[model samples]
Each structure stands twice: as C-alpha cells, then as structure tokens.
Target: MKTLKFKPLVLALSVGMYTVVETSTNASPIVGAELRIVLSEQYRSMIEEDVEEDVEEDVEDDVEDDVEDDVEDDVEDDVEDDIPMDTQDNLVDAFEDQIIMSLDELLEDSDGESTYSDDWLVLADDEQLNALEQQGYSIISTEALKGLGSNLVKLKAPSSFNISKDNPSLALIDSIADVNHVYQLAGRFEPPNGTSFHYNQLLPALSSQQLRLGMIDTSISLEHETLSGANIKLHNVAKEQYSQVKDHGTAVASIMIGQKDGFTGLLPTAQLWSASVFFEHKQQAKITTAEYLVKAIDWMIAENVDVVNMSLAGPPNAVLEQTVQKACDNNLIIVAAAGNQGPNSKPLYPAAYECVLAVTATDQKHKVYRRAARGDHIDIAAFGVNLLHANAT
Candidate 1:
C-alpha cells in the first residue's frame, strides 16, 4: 500500500466583527495635521451668476429676449464664453466677504454646537487653500490623483482652534470657491475568509494557457508548493512587520494559478500580479485603508492586467470610486467579492461600482452563503463554502 502525504488545508477568513472605536472626545482642530478637501462647484456657479448679472445690466429690458437669444447662441458657439476671465476675477475679489458672511451666519445658527472634528477631508483648490491659510489653516499636502484629475488638498487648522465653540472651516467653504465635497476619511475593509475542506479525489490537470490576472490582498508565500512554479509577481504596499501571515494571499493566488498536489486552479498558467495591502491591526483584526487600496489599483492600472480580483469589501470612497471608473474606462475588468457583510448589510464597493463585476458566494447545494452580502449589484455567484486550498508550510 502506498502512503500519500496530505498537507493541511487552510481557509481564507473574513473579518467578522471588527469595529473602529473613536478615540477623540473633544472636537478640536489639530494644527499641522492633514485633512483632504474636495473642490466645490458652487464657486463656478457664483461666477456664472455674476456673468448673467453683467449681461442683464448691459442689455435693455425691451431687447432682453433678443439679447438672451444672442447669449445662448454664443454659449452654443463656445462654452467658455459663459464665464469669462474678467467675471472670474471679480468673483475671486468678492469671495472673501462672501465666505466670511457665510461662516458667520452658520456660526450664529449653530448656537455653540460642536459638529467639527480635528481631522477632515476637505474639497478645495489652490485659491481656496490660500483663503483658508489666511484664515489660519495650514496646508499639509496636495495630491492630484491621476486619470481622475481631481485635486485633493490636505490642510491643518491653527493649534488653538476649537470647533467646539465655532466651526470656521464651514465658513471658509464660501471663500475656497471650488469646494466640492468634504468627508471624514477613517474607514476600513474586512479581510477575505473561507472554510476549509478536504477532497480525496485528484482532478486531472488541463492544458496550461497564458493569462494576466491581478489580486489585491495580503502577502503571499513565494515558496508554497502549489505556487512555486507559477509566474507570480508581488508588490508590497502595506507596512512591514514581523510574523506576517501569507496564508490568505497564497490560497487566493493558488485558486487563481496553483497546480500542485493534484489540485488545479482555473488558470494554472496565468501570470499573477499580487498587491499586498492588508496588515495587522491591533494584533487581531486585519485592516486596510482606502488610500492603500487606491494605490494598489493605480499599480494594477500601470501594469495593465486583464482582470483584477478584490476579495475584500469596504465603504464607498471618492478617490477609490474615481480610480475604479478610470480603470473601467481604460477597458480593464475588475472582479470584486460582493463582501461578507451579511444578508441585511448595505452594499460594499468597489463591488458596487458600475464598472465592476460583483461576485457572491454559494455552496455545492446552490444555496447562498449565510454571511454573503446580497443586492442588485451582485453579478454572479460562485462556490465559496468549505473549498479546498493549498496550505502554506
């Protein structure tokens, strides 16, 4: 009798019950701290209004209809004719007073409410940043995300600034002219997970074919038995740490390109580009931020992979959304897990992005996984319960 040695099968797990607890009690603005600001369209609207006023004043009431027709004609001829340079300059000159009045009115209405936080993601432009700096906010950093063309500027408030008494940033919104949107950028995505199963039957290997596949997950073990012979590339984007676990990424990579120990992946010869984005958080939960995910996507885009797999889920982020949209526009296919947020949980992204193909899980019985998130965004279902995978030694 021949004895066959079987390696232990490990499951790719998900973050089941990890929650971030807010540590700050006081809503004080931290000077020299970074905050992202989105440029608003309101400033452009105000400029358009000034242009309209100028037109109305120059034209007589009797010929107003004729003049309006000519203006519309001019708009059709050249869109830029709507808000010329002189009108824009006038708006910029008046912006300070407008923002001051707006902020004062908001403060008056608040009646000493504390709705501001020390950390914020603001939507503003260079001109707006100047106005904000004049009002005591400090510019920390600025990044113009490629392809999306959105300029995100990080700013800091004065050291003594306390929004608990007054929220000046709210008023600064008016002067910044192009402030688009503001959001608090503290959220995390759950890690991928699965169950382990053993199969005694060995499947025959299919003919190998070349494929370009990308995966964004944890680190992968390069010496794993199943992945040793596969063409796999790694890009480390997470923080370096000791005792790092590569089981999850290794299993995922195996499922995509492994062909060892009698188990074969869908594309055994596919070239894998793996991006490590998850890291240890508090020694328990695996956490990844939106910034890291965006950077991974950017890397994948640069590599021009055919299809990218995101076996993780998190809240919607503007930067991530723009990056995904740009990827789709470039004809890259994005395959994402629909998430393990439970049946009643809200939809997750980039799975929710229109350009992505959101995949959910099911068992051999064709029943949906209990923890699988369900929604109209889910594009397909796959067998994900108790699947066998190569164990990292």
Candidate 2:
C-alpha cells in the first residue's frame, strides 16, 4: 500500500488553494505545528406559486349557469307582464354587460402562463401558467427553497427558442409580470490550484471532539483512510453518482475532520453533514448548478448544522441569496471561500453576501495569496497556501 503525504501551507477561510511544501533535513514541517490563528469575532447576520385550475373551472361554470338562468327568467317575466320593448332591450344589455364583467374578473384572478429565458429559474405563481406557456416556458422540476417555506420551480424554454445577446434572458425575464425573480443557474466552479500529490512525514494524531459542521461540495470518499473515525453524513443532492477522483470534496472534508493513524484534521470530532452538489464531468470541469446548491442548503438547514463550509464560488444568484439569508436567520453560520479569481476579480458569492463570512487565503508568513480574491467583502484570512491535504483515492 502506498501512503500519500501532504504539507500544510495556508488555510483558506472562504476559498483558496494551498501548496504542499517539501521538507528539509534541518527544518521541521509545519504540518504538526500548532497554528496560532486570530479569530475574528464579528461577521454574522441575517414564494408560493400555484393556480388552482379546478376551482377556476368551477367558478366559471357556476357564473355561466347563474347568468343564463337570470337572463331567461327576466325575459319570461318581461314577456308575461307586457314590459316595453325598449325596457326589455335595456335589461338584456345590462345582463350581457354583467356576464362579461364577471368573466373578466374571473380571468384576472386566475394564473396565466409566465414567460422566461432559458437560463433562468423562474419563481412564478400558478396563475401565470397560461402566460408562461404562451411564451414557450414550462416547469421541468420543482424543489423546496428552504427557509423561505416555498417551492422554486425550474422552467425550460421551447427547443426552438433562442436567447441572443441582443435579447438576453435577463431582460426578457424581467419583463414578465408573474415572475417573482429570475435567478441565473451558475455553472460548477473549478477547484483551487496546486492539487498534485506529494509525500511527507506523518503528523501525530490529535484529540477527537464533536462539532456540528456542514459542507457543500463534491462527493466525498467515506472510506478514505484519513476519514476512518470521522462522523460524516453524506447526501447526494447532485443526483449523480460519486466520482472516482473525488479530489475536491474529499480533500476539503479531510481538512475539516479526517483522522487516521498519525494523520489528523482541524476537527477530528466534527459531525460533518456533506451535501454533494458538484459532479465530475467527462469533458468539462466539475461543476454544480444553482438549483442543486439551493437544495444542499435546504438539507443543511434541516440537519440543524452549526456552521457551513462552502469551498465553492460562482456568480450572484437571487435564489442562493435568499437561502443564505434564511440560514443566517436560523443562527447557522456560513463561511465561504472568496474564490480564486485573483485579487482584481469581482467578488463572488455567497462570500459577497452581507450575512456570510468571506475568507481569503494567506501564506505561512501571513501574506495574502496572489490568486485569492481581494475585496471589501473579505472578512478574514486563513492558511491555504502550500497546505498538505489527504488524497481522495
């Protein structure tokens, strides 16, 4: 059996890669050294769509029947009592007007089809179905947007419909009156750099104690050596099989609580509930969608997790924002990577959200990692440069 070694570089609070350092004859590797980290005290904060078609049908039928019966009674009475011809015409016109007004009101109260772009996840009421269907949109799936206590529907556009740059989906979705919000489905984020394998000396085991932690990332290798004694609960919300590579999620998990033989993690006793939202693709980099991420957060909330560690980053999404806010309101702390988009890159979320604690990477000397995102949103820095991590395989 071959044993893999990793060196501790830096700890990325939000998101950044750490490198593994080779050991020298005279200097001891920092893997076993007690890290003196400054903990920041601050940093914390915090749609129903349905249309009842059966009820609408019932109302329509009742209204029509009442109108017809009233008109017939009025006509019969007018004929039998010798009412004037002009009075009879006026009565019929009034009845017709009343029927038209009633129908209009009923139609207004009912949901119509809502229009949206292909890239949007629309939250629309059931009454908007007619308008949406007219615009070539249909519900493909539905999931609970946890904390909001409402279900978010995933909609798809017609196969022939095209969203050109000149007519972006965002603008089209915004024009829709029924849509509460149209959120862009984010693609999977690539893992941090410097993930090559290395050999190192094993560090002594640390004491195990229990802590509630949540992780939203790729599938983890539960049987990995480093995770031998870790209390981990795995949920596959990504709807895909666990990947054999399993590098990203496994490494992140091991860093959180894996322990075997002489190797240890930051929290050997952590009760980790991992929600797998990312999956490895054949030709593309591992990625996740906004829908899966929302589901993962919902699962975390249900588990009553204390802190959530998100080592992934992507564009700002309304659905994600709502979910994060709900998590904070429930007193669950959210820690996200500031992303590896580099110092000049725009801030990524949920790190950018006001309620979340954004973490950047730092080196042994406490210098910021060159690739780590820099912005006012960053709340703290952690070691993530040249850090030794457990191998997934």
Candidate 3:
C-alpha cells in the first residue's frame, strides 16, 4: 500500500457568537515611523527604460489588433485567439517592504499581542441552524429569528460548522452584505505618490468593457463617500477579524475603488470581491498563518473570477503555492503585491510562483519603489507610494 502525505490545515472560526456587548472595540493599525519614498537616478533611468518598453509593446499590440481585426472581417473570429491579448500577464516585481518595515518600527514600543475586536451579525434559518447545533456544533446567533424561521446571531470569536482533517466543508455565502451587522476596522496608509490616478483613465474603460475586479483584502466601507455608487462584494474570510477592516483592507480597497473626480484606480469600474486573510490587530507584526489566503484562492477558483488582486505577502509556504497553482489552472488572473522587503529574490510564495503575476510598486514619476523586489521572476511594476485612497467615513 502506498501512503500519501497531506499538509496540515489550520481551521478558522466562521461563526461569530457575540456576548451581549454594549459597544465595539477594534485594534488600531500599525503605522510606520518615517514616510520615505525616493528613487535614485539609476532607478529613474530604469523606469524610463520600462516606460519605453511599454510603449513599444503597446504599439506592437495595436498593430497586431489591427491585423486581427482585418482577418476577422474576412472570416469568423476565434475568441481563444483574442483571449491572451487582454489577459494580464508578465508583470514586474513591486516590493514596498520598506513600508512594512516602517510600520513595524512605529509599533516597536507597542505590544505585538493585541487583537482586533468587532462584530459579525448573521441572520440565518433557525431550523437549519438547530439541526447543525444538534450535531454537537454550538449555534451562535440567528438572523431574522423573530418570524420563527430566520434568526440573527452576533459573533465574537471564530466558529465553524463542519471542519475535520479528512474533509473540510468549504462554505460559500452568496454576498458579503448578506452577512449583516459587521463592524470593520480601517487601516491608514500614505497613498502612493507619482502619477495621481483619475477615474477618467480607468473607470470609463472598465465600464465600456463591463469588467469587474475581485479585491481580496481585509475590509471595505460600503458607506464611504469615495466608494459611492460602485458595485462592491464583501466576504469575511477572517471571520472574527472584523477590526482589521478599518485600518488595512479598507484603505487598499479605497485605493482601488474610491471615487474621487480627480483620483481613480487601475480598474475603477472594477467591483471589489473583498476577503481578509489577516486581522487588523495582526498588523503589528508579520502574519504567521496562510490559511485565510489559501481559502481566498479557493473561493476565487470556485467563483471563476476574472482577476484576484492581493496586496499582502509573507514567507513562502507549500500550501500557498499549491493554492496559487490551482488558481492558475482555473484560468484566474492572480496579481499580488511584491513583498515590501526590498530586493530580496529568495521568493515570496504566490508572487514567486510562475502561475502568478508579480506587481512591484513605483512612484508617480514611475520611479521604482525603493524597496521593490527584483529578479528574473519579476514581471511588471505599478505606483504604490504617496497614492490617494478613501478617507475614514
């Protein structure tokens, strides 16, 4: 008999059990001590070269598109032939690890053990939950429980339904808003500097193409003024890590979707599919677990999403690699933030994998982010410093 070895899986609490608390408390985000964004002449020269290359590539594509259009006019067009042209591939490495290091420096004096606290109120079917509870799993709260059918539950710690070593039951909730009564924390970031993105640049393009983006991040504010009128989809993979929403993920999402007449994202018409792998409290130090990220990949695969934009990184893990590979196999475009750790090519899991697209940060002037990672693995670069995002509402 042959034995197959499986990697150990970490179980996260999915259900929230709130204990009659009056108000809410969330952990503060970690901020860096100094805000530094400088690109040397050598780096500037590199950016110029890259920009030239990009222009050349665009010209080539335009010529190819013209030729293909002429061909299609004569014969039926094959969609598969056009697919690769629009697909996002060959991105450069954009690491702003300096930002993370600065954040850690700012929190140097603070204790790293603090946890974010928030609430997730879920309205569920009572009979179904009761059936689940009867199976030795405790029932936390039910939504719309008043009409004898639906109930609401306020959750605090992470809870689960059916989790085991052999079979892990992955739950797919329809929409983020459906999981009502969730208090999210906000992360403060110094928007990347250099080119100020405007809606005109990205929104009109996306709207014309009817495209949406899946932002797998920590949190988002549905009521934020900048995020007004944009289609957003939220999912809480962190389950109990609602507090982190305020400080981190919300800021990232805002950068991607925040509505400023003058400021826009790379994909403004892009609707966000928000998911969190780390809690707000965990930002004081590096996150040790990769399960939440893995689950996010699994969710994307299941949903057959167009693009998965994640701005988080950590030490590489085999499970993380496998999940990224699977996502690639599913034809999902996975874009990840290069580790902020600067010039270290040791390899950062999903970003390091051939299946994923590694994006490094550049300045508004298109200068390379000082701490951006580099190597043969790097594919493309983008602005990550002094950029603008949604303010706390």
Which prediction has the highest TM-score against the true structure? 2
The lDDT of each candidate is: 0.54, 0.54, 0.43
Candidate 2 lDDT for residue 2: 12
Which residue runs does candidate 1 get wrong by more than 4 Å? 1-208, 240-244
**Cα-based lDDT at residue 171, candidate 2:** 43
Clashes of each: 22, 39, 53
lDDT per residue as tens, model 2, 1-393: 111111121121132222223211121110001112111111000000111233344456556766655555555565547867667555554554454334321111112211111234544344444445556655656655554455556654333333232234434544221212112112122344554221222223233445677888777878777776678999888664435336677767666675665555666776889887776544234656666777888788888887787877766656567777877888777777777767998887777888887777765567887777898888777666555556665
Model 3: lDDT of residue 173:
28
lDDT, candidate 2, at 304:
89
lDDT by residue for model 3 (20-55), tens: 111111211111011122323344355445554554
TM-score of each model, paired residue for residue: 0.55, 0.58, 0.49
lDDT tens per residue, model 1, 1-393: 111111011111111011111111111100121222211246656656776666666665657687776874565446465658677556554673365334432111112221122223343445665666666655655655453334455554334333322344545454211111211111222333443332222222233546577888778888877788989989987663424556567666666666665566656777889988876544224656555676677778778877777777765655467668878877666777777768897887777888777767765566887777788887666556555555454
The alpha-carbon RMSD values of the candidates against the true structure, listed in the order shown, are: 19.8, 19.6, 28.4
